[model samples]
Target chain A: MSIDWQPFLLTLQLALATTLILFVIGIPLAAFLAFTRFRFKAIPEAIIGLPLVLPPSVLGFYLLLLLSPASVFGHWLDTWFNVRLLFTFWGLVAGSVIYSLPFMVQPVQAGLQSLPLSLRHASYTLGKSRWQTFIHVLLPNIKPSLITGIVLSFAHTIGEFGLVLMIGGNLPGKTQTASIAIYDEVESLNYATAHVYAAILLLFSFAILLLVYSIRKKLQGSITGL
Target chain B: MIRINITKQLRLAHENTQLSIGTTIPSNTITAIYGPSGAGKTTLLKILAGLVQPEQGAVEVNGRIWLDTARRVCLPPQQRSIGFVFQEYALFPHMTVQQNLQFAAGKNGDKSYIDKLLHLVKMEAFIHAKPSQLSGGQQQRIALIRALVRKPQLLLLDEPLSALDDAMRHELRTELYHIQQQLQITTLLVSHDISEVYTLASNLIHLEHGKVVFQGEPQQLFGAASLSSTLQLTGEVLQVIPDGAIYTVEVLTGKNIIRVTAGEHDIAKLQTGDKVCLFVKAYTIALKKMNG
Candidate 1:
C-alpha cells in the first residue's frame, strides 16, 4: 500500500545529471552559434531544435537504434570502454540531454546575441584573451538567461516520458522514472498511487517554475538598482 | 613615433570612397584628428588599433611593426599595447568601477594602480558603483582611466566627452590635458569640436572626404592666433613695400590703416586688396605717441 520512493529519487538523479551535462556543453555551443557566421549555420541550429517539434516517440525510436550495442557508435563504446548504453541509467540520461538540448541552448543564445557589440570590442582593445573575456565579461552579463536555460533543461528532463521509456525499457528501480511509474499505476487501475505520483510531479514542477520567475525578478531589480 | 600609411575602402551614403592616410605622429604628444563625420577619422583610429585591416599599408608604432600589408603581417588588437576609449563609453555594465579597473589591470599589472587612477578622476567614492548607476560623464571618466590602467603606449580616444553636457565637457577637457601631460602617453583624439581640439592638441590633422587637408600645428591649420597674441583682425591689404628680407604691408581695418611688417615669405602670398586675417602679439605691437 505504501508508495515506492525509489522512482521519485531516480527521477531527480537523472534530471540533475542531464542538467549538469547540458550546462557544460550548452554554454560554448550557444556562444558559438550566437557570435559566429558560417555557411550552414541554420542546419545545426535546426537540428538542435528538432527535439522540440519532433514527437518524443520518433526521437526515442532513432536513439534506440543509435545506442543499440550492435550499432557502430554503441559497438565502439562497448569494445573500447566496456560500456553499454542500452536499457541503462546512462542511456536515460543520454536521451534526456538530447531531448532537452534546445531548451538549454535557445535562451542562452538569445541572451548572448542581445548584448552590445562595444562590450566585446572594449574587452579586446584592453588586451584580454577570448576565454578571459567570455568568462569575466560575457558570462556575468547573461546571468538571467543562464538561469533560465538551466531551469528549463532540468524541468524538461524530469517531465520526459516517451524517450526514457523507449531507450531504457522501463526496468523497475533502474529506468522506472516518476513519469513511467505513474503510467504503470494508471494502466493497472491503481488509482491511489497514480494520484500520489501525479500530485508530487505537479507540485515540484510548479515550485521550480516559481523559483525561476522569482530569481528573474530579483536579477531585474538589481539591474535597475545599478 | 607612430607612422601610418594605410588605405581602406568605405561605403558612405551609398557611394564608394577610398581612405588613404599617410602620416607620422611624433612621440610623447597629443595629435587630434579633426574631420567631418564621413571623413574616415574613426576608421583611421580603428586601423591604428588593429581593429581594421588596411588593404595596402604599414603601421609602425614605437619601432614595432603593427601592420605591414606587403610583409603580410597584421597583429590582432589583443596583441597591440594600445588603449581605446570607444565613442559609447563602453564600460562593462555588470562590473563595478573597481572591478572594471581590475579587469583591465591584467594578471601581471599592479592592482594598487587602480586606486591611483580612481583618485585622479575623483571617483574613489564610486569604486563600488556599477557603470549603469553612474551618469554619462561618470561612465566616461571610468572608461578613460580603465584604458590608462594598463599604462598603454598609445591612447586612442574617439569623442570621449561628446556625450557629456557642455559644462562637463569643458571641465574634463582641462583635466584631460593635465593627465596627458603628466603621463606623457602618446594620444590620438578624433573630435569635431574645434575648441576641444585647440585646447588639447599639440598637432592637428584635418581630414575632408577621406583625405588629409592639412597637418600641422593647431594654430597654423586654423589660421587663429596663439594665446600669447593680443591683436587679431580681419583686414584688406592696401600695399606691400619691400624692405630687405621683410615686407611692410599696409592693412586697413575698420577705421585706421595699420602697417604690419612681416618676413618676405609671409608677404609673398599677400596681394593688394586681398582680405587676410592678421595676428600681432601684444609685445610685437608698439605704442606710439604724437606731440600734443
Candidate 2:
C-alpha cells in the first residue's frame, strides 16, 4: 500500500508557522505577565492559562463561531483583508496557537520571573534601555525556558487533533493535518495507514521530548554550576 | 555638590516607614550613607540613580537636575549618567568580564578606556572569564569597574563589599578607595558596617528609620565623640567571653579583630553584631612611620 505524504508535510508546515508566530508574540506577553504589577493582571493571566485546563473542543467551538463566515468578525475579515479563516490551513494555525499558548507562555513567564531583578536593574543603570536589557541581558539568561517554550509549542501544534478537526475540517491537502489524516484513514478502515501515521507521530514526539529534556538538563546544570 | 530633598512612603515588612531625607553631599567625594537595616539607604541610592521614584523630591547632581517631582521631570536611569553597583555584584553571568564592561561602555565606548579600567582593577588576566567562573571578590571588582567604565557623573554602591569575607572585604575596600580617588567621581555608598564607612567615606549621611539624622564628615559623627583619644576604632561585636568578674569581648574592627576588656555594664548591653566604639588612649598605642 502506498502512503500519501501530503498531510505530514502540511502538518510540519502548520507547526512551524504556529511556533514562529507564537515565539514572536509570546516573549513580550510573557515578559509583561512576569513583570507587570497591574491590578487586573489576574484577568489576563487567567485568560492565557485557560487552554491548559479547558478541553480542546470547547476552545475549538468558540473559535469556530468566531471565525465562521456567518459571524460578524469573520465577515469583517473577509471584507477588509479578503481573508477566510474557517476550514483553512491558516485557521488550523490560529486554533493551534490559541490552544498551545499556555505551553509557550507559562515556561517563558516562569523563566523571566526566576531571574534576579538586579540583572535588569544593572543593565538599566549602565545606560541600557528597557528593550536592550530585555533582549541582551534577560533573554540570554533564560535560554532553557525559551527552548522549552519553542519545543512545546511545536510539538503541541503537531499533535493537535480536536481543535484542528473543528476549525479545519478534513479537506485533503489544504487542511488535512497528519492527525486528521490518521483519523480519516481509521474511519475508512485503513488500519495500515493509521498505524504508520501513529507510529511516526509517536516516535517524533518522543524524540522532541527527549531533546527538550536533555537540553534542559544541560542548561540547568550549567546555570547552577555557574 | 549633590543636593537631595525627598520624601517617600515605604511599606516595610513590620511597619510603614517614611523616608524623609534632605542633605547636601560634596561633589567628587565618597559619601557613605550609614544606617541600620530598613533605613531606606538602598532606596535613596536608587532614587538618586532614577531607578526608584520619590513621592516628592528634587535631586540636583553637580548642578544638573536629575529629578524634580513638582516639575514632573525625572530623568530615566539611562539618561541619568549614573553607574550603580548592587549588593550582590549583579554581573551578567552570560558575559565575560570584558563583555560586561563593553556593554556598560555603550556603542561609542572607548576600547582603550575599557582596557584601562580592567588593568586598573588588575582584572586584565580574567578579561575573557565569565562572572560564574570568577570568585565573589573577582566579580565584585568587575562590577565596580563596570560601573565606572561609563565615566558616570554619579556612582552609587549598595553595600558593594557586604558579600565578601573579612579579608576580601578589607582588600577590595582599599582598592575601591583608590579607584574613587583616582576617578574623582561623586559616589554614594550604602553600608551598615561602621568600620567600612570610617575607612572609605570622606563625608557621611547617617540615616535612622529613613531620616537623615546626621550629615557631616565621618570624623564628625564617629570621631568627635572621643576628643581625648588619639586613635578611635569602631567595630561589630563578634563574641563575648566571660572570665571571672571581667568580660573579654571580641570585636571585628577594620583589618584586625581585637578582644577588648569590658566591664559588667558594658557586657550587659553588648550583643553579637552590636556596633561598639573603642577609644585607645595615645599612651597605650604605638605609632611608627615605615620607609617606602
The number of the candidate with the highest DockQ is 2
Q: Of the candidates shown, which would achieve the greatest lDDT relative to the real structure?
A: 2
lDDT of 2 by residue, A107-225 (tens): 99999999999999999999899999999999989999999999999999998889999899999999999999999999999999999999998998999999889989999767655
Q: Model 2: how far is A6 from its true place, Å?
A: 2.2
**Can you give the lDDT of residue A33 in candidate 2?**
97
Clashing pairs in 1: none
* TM-score on B-chain, cand. 1: 0.77
Residue B210 displacement (Å), model 1: 3.0
Clashing pairs in 2: none
The whole-model C-alpha lDDT of candidate 2 against the native structure comes to: 0.92
- Output DockQ, candidate 1: 0.48
TM-score of each: 0.84, 0.90
Q: Give the 10-residue window scoring lowest on summed lDDT in candidate 2 chain A.
A: A217-226
Instruction: Tell me the tens digit of each residue's lDDT in model 1 across B1-292.
Output: 9999999997898677899999999988899999989999999999999888878999999999999999999999999989999889989888888889988987777878888888888999998998889988889999999999999999999989898988889988998898899899999999998889989999999998888999998888765554455677878999999988788999998758989888978887789999988765677666699674
Over 4 Å off, model 1: A224-226, B221-292
CAPRI quality level assigned to candidate 2 from its DockQ score: medium
Output the number of the TM-score-best candidate: 2
